[model samples]
Target: MSKEQTLMKLSAILIAALLSITSVAAFSHSGGTDSKGCHRNHKTNDYHCH
Candidate 1:
């Protein structure tokens, strides 16, 4: 309701969003896995980026 309270809430929401994005990178796997149709290890495959 108040200006100060509103700013505080906005900052908290921003921080939470930023942290969630950073956390995603931590769990992310950079290496691609070989699948039924695609051999990620082969040089010819281009389905996904590692």
Candidate 2:
């Protein structure tokens, strides 16, 4: 393979990895209600009774 081809492949791989990481981070949940009746804010990560 040529140097250009190898670079392109590496760039594609890096882009794919970054996209996957970003997607996981975007969908990650920080705070939420548990089994009991409760609530929590994602931003504050604080739990409270409902």
Candidate 3:
């Protein structure tokens, strides 16, 4: 492919990757924890400590 075409494709891939990563990180959890600062992942039923 041409240089510009390759760069555009790479940029689009990178942007999509970054957006997915940030969105998952931003909304990974939406629950309240107990006094020990831990919560359960309802989706996976796994408990984690923070």
Tell me, by lDDT, which candidate is best: 3
Clashing pairs in 3: none
- Worst lDDT 10-window in candidate 1: 32-41
> Sorted on lDDT, highest at the top, how do the candidates line up?
3, 2, 1
Q: Please, what is the TM-score per model? A: 0.55, 0.54, 0.52
**Is candidate 1 or 3 superior in lDDT?**
3
lDDT score, candidate 3, position 41: 82
- Error (Å) of candidate 2 at residue 24 is 0.6
Question: Per model, how many backbone clashes are there?
Answer: 0, 0, 0
Q: How many clashes in candidate 1?
A: 0
Residue 32 in model 3: shift from native, Å? 5.6
TM-score of candidate 1 relative to the true fold: 0.55
Error of 3 at 8 (Å): 0.3
Query: Candidate 2 has what TM-score?
Result: 0.54
Across 6-44, the per-residue lDDT of candidate 1 in tens digits comes to 999999999999999999877745444555433354566
Error of 3 at 44 (Å): 26
Q: Rate the local accuracy (lDDT) of all candidates.
A: 0.72, 0.80, 0.87
lDDT by residue (1-50, candidate 3, tens digit) is 99999999999999999999988766555559998889988899999977
Cα displacement (angstroms), candidate 2, residue 7, comes to 0.1
The list of candidate 2 runs beyond 4 A from truth reads 28-50
CA RMSD per model (angstroms):
6.8, 5.4, 4.6
